[model samples]
Target: MENVEQEFLSVIREYERVIYKVCYLYTTPNATLNDLYQEVVLNIWKAFPKFRRECKISTWIYRIALNTCISFIRKEKNIPEIVTLTQEADRSEEDDETQAMLQQLYRMINRLGQLEKSIILLYLEEKSYEDISEITGLTVTNVATKLNRIKDKLKKMNKED
Candidate 1:
């Protein structure tokens, strides 16, 4: 039992950043980042024992995290939250521009529906369409189609600003 617990902890440690990115992107006022993070970790733990080696560990983790966050949103009946990245108040001019763009991208992403956000987030992480399909339970063709649409939607958002 202790060994199982330790092994699970190591999995969490290995995927900590990936888990947190999913939580951060899915965060809302109703479900704070920490709240979502806890939920994802808990879900991962519950599912860990039964995890078959049929899929990649990262895919399994993303599936759990995305589903947990999406279900939480549905139960809360709350809107998606815009995530702002924190940087030191004093920063270089180039850094400020880069930060602003990232914030804008996050803002646009926040405006997306839950599934859309999940697809786009996976896309940004450089997951192939097949990997995204696996994680999101969408077909590879569907993932590619949605990626194109999401890109166009984001472009429209930029134009609107």
Candidate 2:
């Protein structure tokens, strides 16, 4: 039991950033982000024992985190919280431009439907089509189709802005 607990802690420590990134992208409010992060952690711990070595640990983490975020968002639909893109206060000038672009991108992402948001998030994270497909339960061809359509949607949205 102690060994399992320790292993869980180690896994959480290694993948904390990835989990946090998923939570951040899904949620805007700091409080909600924290809540979602905790939920993801709890789910990870609960599911750890059943984690077969079939997929990479990171892939498993992504699947769990994304599912938690999506479910939470669905449940919180009535709350109507204000969503923001960036949370950081202090930033270097160089970072400002990149941050601004990211903020704009996230703004667009926020408008996307839940499934599209997941696909784009995976793509932004540099996941390969196969990895995204596995994580999302979409076929590789479906993932490719969705990504292409999402790109076109973003392009149109940007042009309209």
Number of the top TM-score candidate: 1
Candidate 1, 19-124: lDDT as tens digits: 8888887777788888999999999999988999899999999999999988888887645457665432233555767778887988899889889999999999
What is each predicted model's overall lDDT from 0 to 1?
0.87, 0.86
Q: In model 2, what lDDT does residue 135 have? A: 98
**Clash count of each predicted structure:** 0, 0
Candidate 1 ranges with C-alpha deviation above 4 Å: 79-81, 87-94
What is the TM-score of candidate 2?
Answer: 0.90
Q: After superposition, which runs of candidate 2 have C-alpha atoms over 4 Å from their true positions?
A: 28-31, 79-82, 88-94
What TM-score, to 2 decimals, does candidate 1 have? 0.92
- Listed in order, each prediction's TM-score against the native is 0.92, 0.90
- Cα error, candidate 2, residue 6 (Å): 1.6
